[model samples]
Target: MKYSLASGLQPPFTQRESFVRSHPDLYWRNKGIAAYEQNRATDAITAFRRAARYADKPSQAMIAQMLWVGDGVPMDRVMGYVWADLAAERGYPAFIATREKFWHELDRDEQRQAVVVGQAVFDEYGDEVAKKREDKALLLARRQITGSRTGHVGALIVSLRLPNGDFETVDGALYYADKYWKPEQYWEWQDSLFEKLPEGKVEVGPLQMPPKR
Candidate 1:
């Protein structure tokens, strides 16, 4: 089916004034969208990617859409999934449902690549969220940063015998405990899984929120 950027599936980023003003490539993208509607697949794919190189959010989502449906280019399942996933992460609700549908359609190999991407983003950012909540800062980081949770299985627990003194694996994915850590101790392992306890106390969630005014 032909997809329209004007449809409800279209996101808001494309409407940003700066997005249109700053991207010279958008001309080609607009042309390509028109061409695709007219059944010009090859031209549309070429134009879409050209636009996407400088695209902020909406354009990226549209490119992913084109790839997802094999509209303008040969269907590359892995790339398509990644692009669509990215779009969804950026608050593109339309991408959420479609990306999920495409995920299930992928072969085993394609699914595995998605898993790797999933693990990397989660492991690196999960602790950050926990830290923010712990600080009890008034401002909340946009959920966009934590959006990656939508993907699949996180990292595994290796052995707690590495040189780092923390049984962590950098090979596949990194999954630290969801809990917090206490101050230093010899054998007192904090909330984390490591060779030794953390050097200082690391709290997750609002460990110290001052009393309300």
Candidate 2:
């Protein structure tokens, strides 16, 4: 079964549990959605609030919306604005409009209060989003460069034994590794290996090149 918050339909309990077990960050958000659909506002609020602590964008958006409508929590537009702003900052497209709506509707005093609250939220969660994104990028980069020496020094040139029982020359790169260097001969040595390469069975494939400075 599938779950779509927009559709207001929750996935099977077992599936949701399994999903949450593997991705604990999603636990509160998914639980909140299920609770909301079941008309359990208090439970939904609790779940959504917990999710927000983990920087769950949709949960932040939902808490903002719920606060705006006084669905489960007391109607507090300032709090709503704070969460909406947080959600929007997280790049949750659905909450972008909600954040703008809150901004345009709130008065100066309310906006000021929201700014304080939003700043607190930012201070608490900003690094969480950034770290999550960085982790994802590293994971993706590793997958993309799997089985191949994508990043290497000196133009990433590589020698490999071809299937035809012949050695072939190729280009490669170092896999997002750190490099330290200085001008060996006034830019003549464009590439230098400051770090030792890991020992392992190297895969021979596509030619990769060092990034141009």
Candidate 3:
């Protein structure tokens, strides 16, 4: 389900801020898309990198595309392959295909370089590290909303705006549905937001490569 604020009801600014903070992967990914569409390649890359830190697969793919063609950053096919491989970790078919394509495009030297750079990338942005970062953010967001470390404070009523304009008033302990509270569920939900790409089509495919200076 698409997690968004109520359409009709305007939530407090702080509440909206808290919501964005809780799901930074989504925020930065969307921000990257906007910047990219506006031709702000540098800003888009920066935003996508931040999103990748939270395990945003699409953002990871986008970063790989930009880095591959030197759109905003220097061309580094090795690092591009590394990011593509990272994006493919969860076995998404599109991402997996893209990763393979990147590998096939590389020479033996670049492949070796990719393996080395991949280790460093994984140490920082792999699911093991990235998921923990997002989990901590979610935990902190829940604490702020429920005002309790355990996400419970007896009879605390938390009203959440549902997609259909209805408000679901739930206990503080249950305020965040599994999709928002549980890291795995949250990742799945976010994954669902990705549109299915055509076979052999990378969603963030490279444009024409810029001429070398």
Candidate 4:
């Protein structure tokens, strides 16, 4: 049930629709993750902040992760510690590892405070993390779009132009042999897609299609 971009599954749960049905916090949490993965820090912060409002223990732990490194949000080491401790109290493996990983950063007092709050949150939301994982898996499965091209050659040419300090249009669409269709980040994405693309009659991943000769 692990959800990953490589799996080629579209998110099963509709963010907008499901958000209305489930707890607002959970919806925002998922949104935050999506934004973060897409490299949208500002959007991620907004979603993570909202998730904090009604967060169970697992959600709080994720919030702590966001705070600690500013991964997709602002930096707040102390807050991170607090959330991590809460996760550890519930015996969450990742939180426990993180706490130990950063043990030396905090003083005795901060550590003690984290332990106190963490235990309480853990008691309340330990099981929620499992549910969250399930939710993520469902989302991934739902997102699977048949014939949805993650890699397209023409769009990639535009993307390649932009990355190496070249000027290009904001529109992602590209023209190869005078046919235009779709938008893309650049050719590097395409190159990457070609190199790592699964082997097939036509493998597609990082470098599926080389530039026209």
Which candidate leads the pack in lDDT? 3
Model 3: runs farther than 4 Å from truth? 1-18, 152-175, 191-213
lDDT of 3 by residue, 65-119 (tens): 7888787789989998999899888766566667888899999999988887789
Number of the candidate with higher TM-score, 2 or 4 = 2
Residue 123 lDDT in candidate 2: 72
* 10 residues in a row with least lDDT, candidate 4: 204-213
Q: Pick the candidate with the highest TM-score.
A: 3
- Measured with C-alpha atoms, the lDDT of residue 99 in candidate 2 is 75
Which clashing pairs does model 1 show? 134-205, 159-167, 160-167, 165-195, 166-195
Q: Residues 1-213, candidate 2, lDDT per residue (tens digit)? A: 121233223323213333243333367777887788778889988888776665566676777778876875799999888877876663333455567777889999998888777777777655455335434433444434443444224455445554457665543342122310111221121111111123664332221111212
The per-prediction CA RMSD against the true structure, in angstroms, equals 22.1, 18.6, 7.5, 15.6
Q: Rank the candidates by lDDT, best first.
A: 3, 2, 4, 1
Predicted structure 2: lDDT: 0.54
Whole-model lDDT, model 1: 0.44
Give model 3 RMSD, 1 decimal.
Answer: 7.5
Better of 1 and 3 by TM-score: 3
Which lDDT tens digits does candidate 1 get at residues 5-118? 433332233333322332333455676666666777777666765554433234445666666666547776776777666545533344455567678889998899877775
**What lDDT is reached at residue 179 by model 1?**
17
